[model samples]
Target chain A: MARQPLRKVGSTWKPPGKPAGQAQAQDPAGSKGEAALVAGLRAGDAKAFEEVVLRYGPRLLIVGRRILGNEEDARDCVQETFLATHRSIGEFQGRSNLGTWLRRIVTNAALMKLRARRTRPEESIEEFLPKYDPNLFRGGPRNANALTPEELLQRADTRKLVQEAIDRIPGSYRTVLLLRDFEGYSTQETAQLLDTTDGAIKVRLHRARTAMKELLAPLFDEELR
Target chain B: MREFLLKLLLQFRGDKDPGPTEQRVGSWMLRHLPGMLTCPEFEEFIHDYYEGLLSAKVRRRFETHMQLCPMCQVHFDSYVRAIALGRQVCSDDEQLPEGMPQELVAAILLARNQDLDS
Candidate 1:
């Protein structure tokens, strides 16, 4: 018999009967509640699996969107993450938090999607990176102004501005910045995930960050005055 | 300080020139000797400095340059802010539950169920 598809539950539909705030209990790895949920998942409990989806799906989707930047690709990768998790549930050792584990899957899925979707050679980000005079101490003039990102925190458009600047970065470095800075992956982890060496990741990450600094100069300078 | 380090380098290469300052190089008082790093030089080390990969002696020089050189200070501050902004907007766990399309969830379950049944 073919399994039935789920009916539309509207936007307010949560996992079975659990309230919203307590849903975190179902998601955090290694917690007793989550461990039991893991057991149910391993036991092939359909409801338990649905609970996991409803709890973690949105965040994973957000991660996918941030990583892949295309709606269809992001959604497809996120869906694949859930399927992968289901297949591999019994093998999870709980060393990493469950959320972290799922995120890793989603990120990898998105990266694979990106590889498949690559249309052209990646652009060089050298022009975007910070440039200083080749000589020492003569790096232009001393500006009395020091602009910090902390000052932009209260702005309503800060996130939008930052996102737009990030969108402008070439893929090669932008991916590194997102993985190292945003995804909280260490250099070694990012290197391993991206199939690159740690030294390569470090160089790309620094260049990416330097480029971002150059790209966001307007906003930072706006706060400076 | 440049002359002091220069003379020390000369001595290490086995060139014989006695200097009181080269002896002063290893003294506890000279431990904080700030290197004369130009703005461009400091820029190169910013990544290493942030990663805590620089030796204490080098870090003192980096910090000293940053404090005394406002240009490098601005550059370094902006670099730090750029990372903060990127992280701010890309936080992994920022979930808007209401924003998740219910249809996606429906599709995922449908696909999973079909996978197992087959």
Candidate 2:
């Protein structure tokens, strides 16, 4: 009669709060009740659709905004992601966590929106990349006075600066950085998604990171003096 | 390669305690190893090394360069630190997306309903 504490629904683990009496941990489908949920989804149960939207919407919205870079586009992307998921659930095999699957859908939807919204040529990332020197240590490779992740949480200005810097990086390179670093894709996966070579992806990722470092230079400055 | 570079580092940087004999050997490697990386070359490989994408031969060369060149060490360490910081910023950024607005959810459900009817 013990209630399970947590369940992995799609890609994320959350407490099985609303769907009472589900036993977790032993079930590989992540949630003991997930099969029924999937069944309802397949059957076009309106409530099933609502439950999933409530569960994964926020995370997916983040993915949307991060990639699409605006409120209106992000909201539109989330809607399309759910509609796409609903249409494609029968084909999803349930091999991966539903959350993981949904995240991918959201990411793709955002990227497609991004491609459509390429109104002007991408801005140059040269100013954002590190200032390399041909001679020696790029001004003696300054000290790593880096902030801790917890420290980053307390620093709103740094976070805002980072957001601004990301907006500055060119689309091609920024997409690579987000996929490889934040979205946790491998170089190969990123290359495949972007239709490029692994070497190309690696180079772009490096440039992206270096550009980010340059942009956030105020926080983590090089030892130029 | 590693031993050779460590010797070279000890000699050029005058690391104080290198024995008389080791100093001679480091001096020898410095002259013999024509293919050793220059500082500029090391700069190119810093990010590659961080990503763990360098080949074994290249990695040995990369490590040797880092050890031998104090400036490059500072440079590489700085770059690596910035990368770690970038990841942290990203982790925090991920928090920005959680707690999706309820209107969006209702909108999704409503859209799904319309799709079903159509």
Candidate whose lDDT is highest: 1
The residue-by-residue lDDT of candidate 2 on B1-118, one tens digit each, is: 6465665555554533334465355434533667667666776786667766678789877666554443455455445545556566666555453576878877888888888889
lDDT of 1 by residue, A168-217 (tens): 88887888887777777777888988999998998888888888877777
Sum up the clashes in candidate 2: 6
Top candidate (DockQ): 1
Worst 10 residues of 1 chain B by lDDT: B22-31
Candidate 1 local Cα displacement, residue A209, angstroms: 0.5
Q: Residues A1-225, candidate 2, lDDT per residue (tens digit)?
A: 221111111123121121111111123246756677788899988887887787667767777777877999999988998999899898989786677777777778888888888889987777754444543333433243434435544665866777787778899898988877777766787787777899899888878877876676666443211
What interface root-mean-square deviation (Å) does model 1 yield? 19.8
- Poorly placed runs, candidate 1 (over 4 Å): A1-30, A134-141, A144-148, A222-225, B1-35, B92-99
Q: Tell me how candidate 1 scores on lDDT.
A: 0.68
DockQ of each: 0.26, 0.24
Among these predicted structures, which one has the highest TM-score?
A: 1
- Model 1 docking category: acceptable
